[model samples]
Target: MSTNLFSGARKALVASIATAVLLGGVTLVTTPYAAASTTVAAVSVSAKINAFTNIDWLNGVWRTGAGFSIPATAANQAAFKAGASVRLADGQVRTISRQQIVGANMSIFLDGAKLDGNKVGAPQVVTIGSSVVTAPVTSPTTVTAHSTSINAFTNTDWLNGVWRKSPGFSIPANDANKAAFKVGASVKLADGQVRKVTQVQVVGANMSVYLDGAAVNGSVVGAPNKLSTAGTTTATPAPAPTSPTTSVIATSNLNNFTNNDWLNGMFRASAGFSIQASSANVAAFKAGALVRLADGQTRKVLRQQVVGSNMSVFLEGAAINGTSLGYPKTVSVVSTSASTPSSPALTTPPATVTPAPAPSAPDTTNGKPLLVGVNLSGAGFGPSVVPGTHGTNYTYPAESYYKKYADLGMPLVRLPFLWERIQPKLGTPLNTVELARLKQSLDFAQKHNVKVILDLHNYYRYFGKLIGSNEVPISSFAAVWKQIVQEVVNHPAVEGYGLMNEPHSTNGLWPQAALAAAQAIRTVDSKRWIYVAGDRWSSAFHWPHYNTQLISNPWMRDPKNNLVYEAHMYIDKDFSGNYFDKNEQFDPMIGVNRVKPFVDWLKQNKLRGYIGEHGIPDFSPSALVATDNLMSYLRQNCIPSTYWAAGPWWGEYALSLDVTSGKHRPQLPVLQKHAKTAHSCTSIGPL
Candidate 1:
């Protein structure tokens, strides 16, 4: 799960500038925060390497390096190093040449023939893991409506493929609707919500009608017979008066809550929440059941989970007010009044209820592979140096780099950086120096019409501590990401957040940690994509072994429906980009085979996929064949990828795509061939 590490630095800047935020129309011009001076524990490679071995690397060839023998004692483990003779479990002595974490043991190569006796030879993998609007019609009004017959085009973009807009609704993108649902026009919902058709999203099979962000019954959706000449309006209906009675059935003490609940149409905890529960109360508040709460809110129960003496209940409606549910106070749960509006329960009595569709992977790419790009490395280098000196220790891609790549048809660039350098300390504002550099690179990419992935290239560790460890709490991870997103919230060139560069040895906590950070990011920006990598170095070959969540229960639950899983693949004996053996031959399908599990997993789970890192060193013609084959396979699957990489400091590196004399590298051409395929596939507006 390791890649070649590099170093660079960020120089502080003091200035104010305007930047566009994503997901809406807002811009901010603010001064940068000064860098902070702090000390952190130096990384312990043995601890890190030991953690990586916890997973089974049945697909050994895809791991970073190799190891052979097991260390029998704590001293032996500490003494372990390349070229050190280590005692095996059988007491046999073996010299360690190259070692990598491969599923609960190090896969070592002794003198290059590659014999990883730790069950590393086969594929022992198992697996795991928006809007609408409307308007009216006219002029033979190219608009037509069917109440519920035509299902809105479903894609991986939204759950049930629903593109919902509050106060608005979505309709099938049939020919007549496409012509009639024009922006600036108005559509009146069957209930009398008059909304302006703000925009239209036509990508592959998805042609959505946005009614300035509204939701309505599909049957009532259609073009208005005529245009409205005034401001938007919603017909209000007089409330039916009733003397509803409330009977207190149960009361419980509120323990805690969070605001990131995912309940749709149901009243959800705006922040997470928990209450003491016993067997008696758990059943009384089952899904689809309605109850009146002291907060003056009535909602249908979505679901409930009980662990120990605590229960978490999700309800459908507007977000619940956590503050109103006073802690340490007994909250009354009352029987619903006959006078209050109600819907059938979400569970039980199937004949009377239709539960909301479970969240599904959005078909964002429209069955076509996403766009191809290259890793613009450098900013993430020099992990050992905190707030490293810019230029000497680290650097970001220049404007020319973006220009050259965009000109070459590579419209995406995955930019990696150390989380430590940006924030310096957890829960603190980002260092102005690092922030300015990142913004500069983003601006350059946007100018070139290229999308960028802001990769937190910290290897799932901040300041040398694995995330979720006491030293690095998961909340800190979420906090950093939340702040980062706030800084660039909706920068147009920003594609997604590479949550981590390559995570390894996360103690089975990566999934929870990753999701926590994602939820935090969503709190600020919900429209941008979030690229999640698997544990065990995010290896496509070993994805199933390291990440074993069932497809039925995906680990990622993005509130915004833009979560894309990422994996890395390198075609070499060790799956490391070093390529020490220059003349090694490779099967043309080697690259494809290594990455197939990841692709297949994505398919089985119905999720989006991305190849975050894949590279072949020069000097091996067969590697080129393998690279080309892998690229073709990705194109056929409609998955996007970024080559491993092009940067300013990678002088003479085998896999470096850093340009020289204005000439393109051999690998660049291979990537270029697949880059243009996504261009015509789907358009979600701009990068």
Candidate 2:
């Protein structure tokens, strides 16, 4: 049994093997034999024709008989070039080229004409040098020959009814053709030529058939009927399907986001088997026309569809079949005058004026109410450096720490965890003890109705090897995230998955790895928001320049389109949150202006921005004022921000928001001011 070489590139190459067959030189023959005889003699010739370029012409007309022979002579080349014509077995006259016949053995067939000692009359058996020639009697005798090689055909009874043309030929595998050879049979080539098939041979686990005395190793032969304009034959290719043209209707910032923005600006609905309109109908849609929805509902456009602007009809209560407009629903223009306008009924007021009802509170659980959050640090940065300890121990805050902050009206918390603590060894399940400690903190936050953002605090490296590098495969990083997300993704308190804490690398490796991790998380939980950060510690200053590669990567986009870009901003003169010296004093408004470019970029791309970490030092009036101004700026722009931290390890640390001397840090008052405007998690509300 031969193995099948019918897969991948090798299979495609084998399927195209017939094209290569025209480039090689081979021979075919016909012989005259007795009709009653069951046995036939064969001859095999192995020789190359010198400088023969017209292999197609030779394959079509060359045949062996008693009267014809091509001689290796210069005069024959001259005669052929002058104007000589050869009559083919089918009675068609074709001009012969010198390059096709020089030094090549050939045969000629003449209708009703005799040559040499052989007579052209009926199907007869003729012997020549241990080779048998079988001729079928017709208006012109059909000449046939057999091969003498070990794998040659033992009979020639199959050459009876096969027909051939210039580019089309048919050799049905009927009983006669099958009986001619045991494992293989002779078939007519596309160029009206007969070729013999002998046996199937195995070469390196692949099956190959010998055709026309030549080894055709795994080459694919085309159907005989399809012919090329050059008089050569090839497989007929399938026609390609046409694609619809896409037109951009709008481009705008996140604040101006509308239903069309979420839909990626695709507008067209199906009508029977075709789309109702495309770019060609843009003029109609822009003229306040009626359009059909995919669900067969017709709605009138309230206003003209903006071509290069960001405007939404969804705001005008536009919907299809009671469902809100979204992606994959095609919309098309119907009529220019059709229109539907929304009107609210007015009722007579009572003698005393009653105040209108208050608007319902926005969903804060979805990260909507100006995220005032604090970074919880102990679990992720590893165990504290304590005296007389090996530093291998892992530490986490007790429930009281979470309770105190929850009581302070903080609505969101950013929780960081170490990768090594969860998975000490590659490919192993998350460590049971470490997972329990992390879950304990998460449970405390849920008790207080505070949402948590799980942060993977690995800096794009594991065990001293950069991810996506030779040392650690990017798949390994994605694998750990898959396991981690499965454990806490469904937790009610968990709001979003922060793919990584910070990535500061080059050549787009950080974004590449971030995309891999984000995709892995999406596989488990598609609805949860995922936070993706750029390289260089997700710096706000270099966001536009350094993160260009990531922002442009199509793969970096989330399938759900629920991604929030995370960036860290610091306020010192050097843009580092290290110190707050008096000499480095700068106006709070100036600091806010410095970070506006990043905010503008986020708005322009229609992407949500989250300040994952930012902070200030001390309770001085100058520092407190700076914090107040920056927080206000972020809130006004609808940007969610989390303060740098409050943890058990920080005792009197300058930037710590932790309680000290039984009083809240000064930054708490600043945070509380912004929290008052947001929906509170605690009954006490903002201080």
Candidate 3:
């Protein structure tokens, strides 16, 4: 059978043809994908006889104004439809397949007869039939029937092939989840009640399931009841409540977190945390376990502390965008109903789990925070010029710039450099000139006690080909990382190796490729942290959509447990650092809202996180507020962040923190204020 080769854009407009169109007896089972843009139900069209001439060969189906029948079996039909050889009247034979259909520009005749073998004429095409199917309206909280694929224990996002493995759970993509969770293809629930996916949210790791715009009672979908205030399933018994009581949970100075065992770890809170516990949860909490809070938040109870006096109670979950907002002013104990005789009324558990006070904290200059840093740019510019002249096409950060930021109270520097400039050839030794320039920067950082994270800002591609693709094999990618690790494994200023800066379109191979690169680094240096960025530009907002495999246990294994996931976010209109609009308005909460997904994912996986890059343009005052808010949020959660940039060449760049005309940029004061509060970095452990 002949077919019209539609362009990718035109293909989206084509829908399934319900009725069988007999073209020499070939049956069109289904179209490529149904049109989802329309809300009206699609109407099917009756079959009609059509014909055409001149045909292409060995690339796709080849026929001219003729009809043919394919084999009845699925396998036979696929093979026959794939390609077939036919003889022309001139004794020339041509094979047909689906490769060269691009730009074929063939036409179909509305009325024609089945041609006998060897009848050749101008190249002809037969446009496939299309009919739209009923689809639901698309809205902020509601998804179309064509887009609803999530079920009780699974979601449409997990099945999108971008994630190679599952996290053993599925949650809808809502404003809270922000993995940019998209249920792109069509799927149906076993109950058939999920015709249209309505509102559902993933706050932290807990998911509130919904179906057809109605709340689901139990953890399972299609349940026949609503959730009660007790936060129990309809099948489970309610717990007994006591009363809301006040207690002096902690009385020590508020600044005592310096050596606190819990606060030393990332995302760990010292006080202002409580959960309505079940019997199992109570046992888990008392044993210093990771308990899921009644409100669907999760935290590992490493230790609980009480150190203050006359602490009035605030019986509410203290969280910012679903993360532990550190140290509430007062502590309160709210009584909770017990589900069983063994379960006690919800009260503050005894603080018996505290381990020995953390070892002497790392040396700090005036007790400056560990992760306050600036992104040192320059080496990564001029992507089109490979192995270009250093001074003209690209340049490394000036030695003085490192000391300037370090002396200005920034203790860390993220150095971005091109991979091609470093190696010149893939899988080869580092270029000596580039290597020397990098070492010089490291030396300057060491002199000023400033940590450095080397960023490979390649955007998951080298010479325009994505890593893990045929042109750039994962082995080559891993090899380069291994060599770089070997060189700086002993450098005192080297904080860690950023595997890649904002990897995008890695074709779902990011998890595998990152793991391979990390394993290679471990072969030389296992103590230092390796920052693994997620696919799709390492976007914190879209972390869940493309990075489930990286978080999935055993999918990405680092033997040393020193892996820190890196994510990037921007508060501009497009989430890109380059603010095209001079006067972009923004909500002060934009920064907090965008990074919540990555932070929540980190907390859920019990892993540390780093914001490798985030910045705001100077054009908008709201941008400054958003920046300050983001820094505050990061500080509260103990997540490290580096501003987008500071380089000698960035003379007029809005986000650049480079000192120009000896004047401080508008963002400097805000950054310095937050930098002073940083007392910890990813380097809490050895190396």
| Lowest lDDT block of 10, candidate 1 | 13-22
Give the alpha carbon lDDT tens digit for every residue of 1-687 in model 3: 001111111111112111111111111122132223434433221111112222322111235434332111111211222234433333444443321100001112222343443344322222122344444443323221222223233122222211113222233322222212212112233334323323222321123333243333223422121111111111111222355432212111112232333231212332233322212223333433333333333333344432221111112222212133233221122222332212222334533222334433344321223666888888887777776888998788877887788767776888889899888898789998899999998998887778888999887889888898888999999999999888888888888899998777677888888888988998998677788888877889888777998755574543355787888888766666656566577754578778888898887766777888887654454566567667767776777788877876765556777635444355776677576552334332112
Task: Report the Cα lDDT for residue 35, model 3.
Answer: 25
Model 3's TM-score against the true structure: 0.49
lDDT for each residue of candidate 2 in 467-576, tens digit (9 for 90 to 100): 88776888988999899889987788778888876677645677777778888987898877688876777777667877776766775553344678888776666565
Per-residue C-alpha lDDT of model 1 across residues 305-366, encoded as one tens digit per residue: 66433566666544445455444333445564475444333233323223323522223322
In candidate 3, residue 505 scores what lDDT? 61
Q: TM-scores of the models, in the given order?
A: 0.47, 0.46, 0.49
Show where candidate 3 strays beyond 4 Å.
1-253, 256-369, 553-559, 659-662, 678-687
Tell me each candidate's RMSD, in Å, in order: 26.6, 33.5, 24.8
The clash number for model 3 is: 25
**Candidate 3 lowest-lDDT run of ten:** 17-26
As a whole number from 0 to 100, the lDDT of residue 128 in candidate 1 is: 8
Output the better candidate (1/2) by TM-score.
1
Per-residue error for 358 in candidate 3, Å, reads 17
> Lowest lDDT 10-mer window, candidate 2?
11-20
